[model samples]
Target chain A: MPKMPEGTVMQRLAQLLFFSALMVFAGYFSDSPAYQLLESGQTELKLVVRHSGNIIGECRALDTGEIAALAPNMRRPMVCPREKAPMRVELDLNNKREFTETITPSGLHDDGVLALFRKFTLDSGDLILHLRITENPDAGGLPRDYEKQFQVDAHSTLIVEYTDSGFSSWQPQHSPRPRL
Target chain B: MKVEAFLDRFFPAGSNPLYQLGAVSFFLFWIIAVTGLYLFIFFETSITGAYQSVESITHEQFYIGGIMRSLHRYASALLALSVTIHLIKELGMKRFQGPRWFSWVSGVPLIWLLFASSLGGYWLVWDEKAQYIALTTAALFDYLPIVVEPMAFGFLDGTTVSDRFFSLLIFLHVGLPLALLLGMFIHIQRISNSSTFPARGLALSLLGAMVVLSVVKPALSLGPADLNRPVQTVQVDWFYMNVFPLISETGAGAAWVILLGITIALLLVPLIFRGVPKPIAIVDPDYCNGCSWCFADCPYDAIYMKPHEKLANHLQSVVVADKCVGCGICAGACPTATPFKSVNNAYSGINLADENNAAILVRTQEQIRQHPQADKHVLVVGCAHGPQIDQLASDVVTPLTLECVGQLPPSYLDYLCRKEGVDSVLLTGCAPGNCFHRLGVELQEARLAHEREPHLRFKDVHVKVTTLWAGAGGETTVARAVAQLQQDERIADAKDA
Candidate 1:
């Protein structure tokens, strides 16, 4: 190996000091000064839609001529369209509308569930929250509505998810956050 | 560039931290892996037990456990530093241009993996910092259309963040780095004989620094994770978690845009700054004789052996132009590149088309005749990337700069000694460990020592030749060596009188 001029002794000492200082400083300030991720009293609101919208077209009886056009194994008395209807969702707080959206179902045949998500920021304390979700919007969908009066700033974040029974509300986090 | 020179002054070339940035990063990864394994021995991969288990290890077995944790985190930070610097330095040097674009493009994903793997390890701690990482990471991921269900839904409450979540975290923290290691391996696939380990002394110094830091101040967490309360202000490792703050400031959508935008820009940088591609090495079937010496010595794997085109049944070296960097190290490795009348085959089997090896010897002979009156004429051969060789010209010293020192075949050095007016030959290129052409110094030294192929076949070769690691701080060294050669010649003349 070709020996370099400065490395045998001086280089090692310098490496020790220089890298020691570098690692020291990096490890020191890696997590310092603290980051302000969110304000103490700021509230985050989210709307989640997991329920799939109903199928769009109703099944209709097929005539003898229509059945003749289909393949032997595929022939049936009635045929229902695989595509599902899109859903409409609207949110109102204290009678004032906050959000409204008509979300379409996913998948090739539009048979997938309506996976909708929306986020908003609102203030805390005594308020009325209303969330309305429509099962199917394309076919004059029925609107399911729920309303509740609660402290908006009860926790830093709040979520209203769609379930089978009705709209459910609670402090989603483990402990209720203290209002500043 | 001066910073690089200053570092070379204190650190040398092969062992310098700047030059070994890539290798040092690999070394740091090994340190993180070992320490991670030791921590896993005592870790519990469950939500309820994870934090408690880590705390116990930190306090009860603080000596081994705490130090390992500290080493794991610190080494990871160092790895990030080294990798980032390595990428920037290579970018500045335009090492990503031409045939090197593959290595450059392949490196883009390594940054993503570095962040992903480090962030995953934070989640394993189940601390406030982990909560922050998980929340921010999910926020960024949730914006993508592929994820129909929001990822933050699981961490919404006490019941949602399950044991399975911790299991996934452990898998990611372990699996992602293994993937990164594989990616690092792929990044060097084009360059043959790439070293993942730095020099012994350098690696030892790096390890020593990490150990000392771990001893001074061990790593600590920001308390257990509590989803019920908001973590307003938290301490986060700036290296891996920098994207989090951006996600917080700019909504997840914009953050995705910025992140992906930067990544795409990096992947396209080579094309943006690409210069006219240098010519690649070309092979001559007539002089090749299928020796395979160049094929074995090519750093970029650009040379291959195939059947000769015109010959009835013989093999010859072939150049894969797409993979060649035109460094001319292959020319130096060619056995046919000799200056002797019997072995005089100036055009080697595999040599850089841009450089005429035949003219190099003629130039040397002409330069030697210019200094015929000088009693001790030293022919100083230098690399283009090496010291400022043009400045070393004088009455007694004749300087010759090649595209690389490797472009000058060993036979040229041998031939210079037997020339009428030339007293001695001095060969210098990149530093001992740092060769712009990767293997120039090693191959040249090997050939001179008669260890590798195409040996310098001249009697008393050592007396006639002087090889030095004359790079950045090497001009003085080269000049001093020339003066010494003259001084030795004078002493010999006196003894003869």
Candidate 2:
């Protein structure tokens, strides 16, 4: 059996070291924002309002955009003059349970608009949104439609779900009594 | 009894352990290469990161990365085994004597390269063993006058040596394997025809073993490499790292000198040791028929087909001289008793009469076509790939015949190229792994590509040289392959054209 040259072993040892270093460098260089995002556990969420009914007002958890619970018999009312078009709202959330929602509405106005009231509840780690829309027959317009259920949490924050379809618009009706 | 007849009686087709072993080794190398590539991606070369990275890959990516690494390592080890076995089989059989001395001499370097490539791969892990290897290896280099300065200063001045030394080592790790690939090319260059794929069992077993090992062990790192901390105990790969301790104890400088001397001595063995020149195997053009069985059978890939337009046989016949490794596989494969005598017939007393008589029986055109013993009508004509042949034969009730497609006599080939009832004459020879025979399947294809010969001009001949792996008992595989080729209208058209 022929033996390998002595230098061959040394050369091989050197090669091994070199390749290991190169791989390390490659791994280190692969640090990008996208990679960081995945590593840090950041997620995105979209909220969409349904067109079936008017959305008077909504609240959400400041953190994680989750809906917060509402007090029993208490409601936040929002006014909508017309319901021909849709409305979109964007919100941001943090780790804390606090959240805020911003809504942008654009459409034609109708006299007989529906009033929307929504409440959020959180129980057993589940967020449930309760919605009540009131339509006025005294007005000349047709009755409002309530197509899908709205979800909320314990904090009574309105939960909006986003889909590929555009946001659903809502019209609110004026109530005779206002809680000051 | 004629020499050919005697050889035929004993060494018939599918015999020759050396040839079988050579085929086995070729496949093993491929297994090593593929696994090595997968491991290379995740390997970290730095002393600090190497072990950690390996650990992460093995623990976290065990299903993919870790398994691949283990397979690579196991395949590498197996490659060493196959190469060593091939070498021993050659020597014990006395196939390395005479004109084959160059190949024999070159074999030493090939082994050296394999070890070097394997060892380099081990060091990339940068584990405790890797560190020990690094330090001990530096010690060995300290012996060489050329490398002494770097070695001596490398230890004393950590920063100067560590980075540069490591960099140099990295260069070698990548470069050495490339060099080994070149050496492999050169090693088989002298042989007229040789195969890269080993026998079916050997190739599949090697691949299967690698897969199994990867799944079982899944290579992992030992620990983060620390230059300061001494690795008291390290797992040693004795195959390549055995000489490290020798250098550590004997002083690096001394070890280098001694090792250099030994290498020079081994390289010069063929020159120093004299032996009478042995006659290599010769080809007889008259009976050759250009079937290229010898070309396919040659373990060294030494036999080639040279164009001869005027001979009794048209097209090219097997020409053996320069590339002939004297393994006599061509003699064994020649359907016609064309390889009259062993190349070293003068020294070995090979009987040509016996060889010729045996050739007359099996080499005849009638026997080649009408032999009832031929179980499989589907002749897998390709470069002699032991593994593929074994795989194809094991599954189907067909006698899987392999021959250098290049040696297919244009006349008989024209007949078989389009003949009916021959399910599919799948020409399975060298493509990516070209045979030692200069004219492998590609060359034969090239000849057929321009204009189909008159005999093959008929439409039924379904000839195809595939690159897919063919294993034993892979009938569904063979059937699928045949079906696929049969579906190819172009192949049919080409045969008819």
Off by over 4 Å in 2: A1-180, B1-19, B44-47, B155-170, B253-265, B268-274, B280-497
Interface RMSD of each: 5.7, 29.3
Tens digits of lDDT, candidate 1, B52-137: 88888787888889889998999888888888888887887678889999999999999999988988888998888988787778
Candidate 1 chain B: worst-modelled 10 consecutive residues by lDDT: B339-348
**In terms of TM-score, how similar is model 2 to the real structure?**
0.44
lDDT of each: 0.79, 0.45
Model 1 interface RMSD over true interface Cα atoms: 5.7
Calculate DockQ per candidate and list them: 0.34, 0.00
For candidate 2, lDDT tens digit of each residue in B102-216? 7777778877788777777667766656656665665555334333132323322123234344556667877887888888777776655465665554355446545755574
